[model samples]
Target: MNEVKASMAGSVWKIVAKEGEQVKSGEDVAILESMKMEIPIPSEADGTVKELKVAEGDFVNEGDVIAIIE
Candidate 1:
């Protein structure tokens, strides 16, 4: 399994990939809003998204697990 982690502390702005969705490496899985900027969290592995650990508007810190892929 691979964990998709947050790149910075922020509120989740949007989820681009859903559970059970296939994703490739470098694909944006979620977007985060911080300091008026939208930062994208990309998946580092190519696989199906197994779980989402956060929802839109949820606050997350850097290195927090956003999703699990396998």
Candidate 2:
């Protein structure tokens, strides 16, 4: 399993990948809004999305686990 963590503190703007969805490496799985900028969060590994630890509008801190892939 691989954990996809937040690179910076931000509010989750959208979730582009759903649980059980297959994702490729570098694909945007989520988008975060921080400092008035849109930050795209990408998958580091190619796999199915096993879990999403956040929801839209949820605030997250750096290093927080956002999702899991397997």
Which candidate should be chosen as best, given lDDT against the real structure?
A: 1
Error of 2 at 13 (Å): 0.4
lDDT of 1: 0.98
| Model 2 alpha-carbon miss at residue 39, Å | 0.4
- Candidate 1 C-alpha lDDT tens digits along 1-70: 9999998999999999999999999999999999999999999999999999999999999999999999
TM-score of model number 2: 0.98
* Candidate 2, lDDT over the whole model: 0.96
Evaluate residue 46 in candidate 1 and report its C-alpha lDDT on the 0 to 100 scale: 99
lDDT of 1 at 38: 94
Report lDDT (CA) for all predictions: 0.98, 0.96
